[model samples]
Target: MLTVSIWIASSFMGLALLLNLYRLLRGPDIPDRIVALDTAYVNALSLLVLFGIQQGSRAYFEIALLMGMVGFVGTAMLAKYLLRGDIIE
Candidate 1:
């Protein structure tokens, strides 16, 4: 039952990933691309958590946490750059 749920979640995540990838590739505006990238990172994070649970590996969770932090920082910095044209004031 748990395995089935994980598989179903993973499948939906995969579909979301594809859609986000398309947006990232074909977005008409910079903000749209940024949003797509953020979504991709979030979906990737969820997938990592699910994979960690499936594999019973604490390391995967640690990595996922790190990725989430990095993704958040990166997105913030990118947004700052887009808004102010500079990452650092």
Candidate 2:
């Protein structure tokens, strides 16, 4: 059933998010933390998409798009800051 499939997908995404959180907390370096944060953002996006499917709502899709944009910007800034030690530069 569609509902069962959605539940399973949601469970997997939840697990992924937990793993990402562990990495973010246990990272031995800043870059590792950054990557973990990026991955968390992606997993969160997937959860949002799954919720959108389950609820049949367009708003979740819109929110997911917005989050994806923010995630991209955040990831880029994190990488840039790590490389140059200044995000604005």
Candidate 3:
């Protein structure tokens, strides 16, 4: 059933988010942590979209889109900072 599939998918995404959190906290280097953070956001977005599908609402999808945009910007800023020691040149 579609409901069952959504539940399974959401569980997997939750697990992925947890793993990403662990990596973000335990990463040995800045780059690794940054990557983890980015992945976490993506997983979170997936979870939100799945939730939206389950609830049959468009609000969660919109929120997920906004989160994705913010996540991208955050990741870019982190990468830039890592390379130049500052986000803004």
Candidate 4:
């Protein structure tokens, strides 16, 4: 049962990730690309968490956490750059 649920969730996450990738590549505007990138990271994070749960592994959790932090910072910087044309003021 648990394995079945994990497989279902993984499939959905994979679909979302692919959509985000398409948006990132073909976005008509910078903001659109940024939003797509942000969602992609979030989806990736969820996938990592799901994998960790399925495998009963602690290491994947740490990796997911690390990526979450980095993704947040990167997204913030990108937004700032889009707004002010410079990430650091």
Candidate 5:
């Protein structure tokens, strides 16, 4: 039933991604949009890891790591901009 579990996890992640997208589109504030984007990134990473495991590929894991790094950087920059109106000092 490992395959079944993987499929279930993938479905859940996909649903989460869609929900996050809705939030991103309709967020009432900058912070809310940023938070939704961060959550979407995390869900994407989990989906990547699951796909990697299912396909026995290491590349997906690497991509997920890179995406995580990018997501963190993006979130930080967005949050800084929201607070100070600029990403650069």
Candidate 6:
């Protein structure tokens, strides 16, 4: 059933999110932490979209889209800062 599938998918995504959180906390290097953070953002986005599908809500989808855009920008800024030691040059 659709409900069962959504539950299973969400469970996997949740597990992945947890692992990403662990990596973000324990990463050995800045780049590793950045990658983990970006992956965590993606996993969170997937979870949000899955929840939206399960709830049959349009608002959740819009929120997820906005989050996705913000996440991308945040990741980009972090990478830029890592490379140049400043976000704005």
In order, what lDDT does every prediction score? 0.96, 0.96, 0.95, 0.97, 0.95, 0.97
Global CA lDDT computed for model 2: 0.96
Error of 2 at 17 (Å): 0.4
Alpha-carbon TM-score of each model against the true structure: 0.97, 0.97, 0.97, 0.96, 0.96, 0.98
TM-score of 3: 0.97
Q: Put down candidate 6 lDDT per residue, 1-89, tens digits, no spaces.
A: 99999999999999999999999999999999999999999999999999999999999999999999999999999999999999987
| The 10-residue segment with the lowest total lDDT in model 1 | 80-89
Model 2 residue 72 CA deviation in Å: 0.4
- Native-referenced Cα lDDT, model 6: 0.97
TM-score winner? 6
lDDT by residue (tens digit), candidate 5, 1-89 = 98999999999999999999999999998889999999998998999999999999999999999999999999999989999998888
Alpha-carbon runs more than 4 Å astray in model 1: none
Q: Which clashing pairs does model 1 show?
A: none
Error of 5 at 14 (Å): 0.6
Model 6 C-alpha RMSD vs. true structure (Å) is 0.5
lDDT ranking of the models: 4, 6, 1, 2, 3, 5
Clashes of each: 0, 0, 0, 0, 0, 0
> Tens digit of lDDT per residue, candidate 2, span 1-89?
99999999999999999999999999999999999999999999999999999999999999999999999999999899889989985
By TM-score, the better pick of 2 and 6 is: 6
Q: With candidate 6 superimposed using the best TM-score fit, by how many Å does residue 75's alpha carbon deviate from the native?
A: 0.4
Q: 1-89 in candidate 1: lDDT tens per residue?
A: 99999999999999999999999999999999999999999999999999999999999999999999999999999999998999987
